[model samples]
Target: MGKKGILLVNLGTPDSPEVSDVRRYLDEFLMDERVIDINAFQRTLLVKGIIVPFRSPKTSKLYKEIWDENGSPLLYFSKIQAAMVQEKLGDEYQVELAMRYQNPSIASGLDRLKAGLVESIQVIPLFPQYASASTGSVIQKVMELVGKWQTVPPISFINSFHDNELMIDTFAENAQKYQPESYDQILFSFHGLPERQLKKCDHTGQHCLKKDDCCSTLTDVNKFCYSAQCHDTARLIAKKLNIPAEKYSVCFQSRLGKEPWVQPYTSDVLKALAEKGKKRLLVFCPAFVADCLETLYEVSVEYHEEFRALGGEEVQLVASLNDDPKFIDALVAMVKN
Candidate 1:
């Protein structure tokens, strides 16, 4: 076999934090049938007419707040990750990075691998959990692009590493940097998905959102369930941190539209904690590997203010595993294996 190839893909960032750039990014991202889970006409109407026009400017401002001097924290760290993985793997394997939506697109990354005429390619979507909107989208996009290739190589996907020991350890390690015990509560917040999306994946038809504890444990039926995987990720990280189940709570953030999303919502959790006089909270967003607008601005800044107004002392966000050496090691092992 010829040299193997590794492609590390993450959810994209806007070319710039400008409203125009953000609008374009939103159009591409929110318009995806996998993302909005609606017909093109409806999705386009909702995204273009309602979401992009109103949300872009506001979101662009938030993006600017978190935008590092180098660039987007997500893209910057991803570049570092790809470079480090390449160095670790040495000349035996070629490593490339792509953002699923924007700059350094999957098409460009795949083209590079095709130029090398690699024997096989391992495409690792950076999402820890397998959401159709995230990991599934990346896989679908890669297949669509690679399908047209005259000499398509063998390809494999690392779909989900939510419970990978090293990954869990890295998140635990990041949390340990701060005083985990100093906070009143440790909130494990994952990105929210619509309830309908979760049910769509329920092959058992009665598993998702049916029982309260259905997502508490990972079963073969809910193995690919995003909510279940998020809970599992939280459980593993909390276990590593020696956090008692009662002391910490699992919640979801970034709910869109009026339709119910996977609950308990992070905002609701914060409000409840504040009402109960649980101040000085710590939050962990395990769904995201790198600090982006959601983590840096939304959780760190926006949520902080929300909790403060509700009579909480502080809502400290744990830094994500952005270009961390341990995280790169975990990625290296995942790819090389």
Candidate 2:
């Protein structure tokens, strides 16, 4: 018998805040078919020819703002998480950390595990809610690499842990520090997805955007739906905190292009709340387990500025569950059983 191999993967970050490095990272990330969902030629034309070229310089600046002596927050926290998980799991488990894109590639992580001669490999993508562009891409890429191995071991994947009790509690627990009641409006802002993507997840041709209840309720027909899972996550957290259903709003953020993304965008919601005289706002980005550019820069800085310009007083972002002991305990339990 050999040690169990645990591969922990996060979204990823650029090697540095430099424009060149950011460009490379963007090219690799946006070029993913799952991400753009366009033909290869078209995606290449858009990502390489336009998006990466124009966006990289501006995006690098944002990365620089969040970048510290520890470098990228995502990778830094990911390293800490891997170490903690390894320490907790003990010698019986060989844990490796990788990013779905960029440095510490999945190939290197899997190679180390393969060298360790582990009996089985457990893959846990650090995305609370499942989405095709994220967890699905990681799974697909892992399979594409491992399929070529001559001596492949038993492999397992944690598909989605959005409704995990401890995970939900962790977010609620973090918000407790912020005093949720003090805020005028609470926003559970998740990363946005294209409307077409949600439609693709819909097994039934008519079940997607046609129905309104699907977003609030999780059913087998739309169980794999990303929007539904995000809403369910918010619901669980709100329930745990004894928050009223009408008190907080669920919105999506970080959308690209002009296509209609998941509705009630965070920007629009913030603007509306500002106009409604809801000055103090609290935001929870549960989709992200670790504090990254999205949570730190986008939600904290950008959204705060935007809201203030709209006559809002504050846009306080609740901290993420980075290296939290409770989260690690839940992770270990997932791996063991």
Clashes of each: 0, 0
Candidate 2 residue lDDT tens string, 48-144: 8999989999999999999999999989988998999999999999999999999899999999999999999999999988899999999999999
The segments of candidate 1 whose C-alpha lies over 4 angstroms from its true place after superposition are: none
RMSD of each: 0.9, 0.7
Q: Where is model 1 poorest over a 10-residue stretch in terms of lDDT? A: 174-183
Q: Highest lDDT among the candidates is held by which one?
A: 2
- Per-residue CA lDDT of candidate 1, range 108-209, in tens? 999998888788999999999999999999999999999998888889999899998988998898888787988899999999999999999998798899
Lowest-lDDT window of 10 residues in candidate 2? 205-214
Q: lDDT of each structure?
A: 0.92, 0.93
Query: What is residue 319's positional error in candidate 1, in angstroms?
Result: 0.7
TM-score, structure 2 vs. true: 0.99
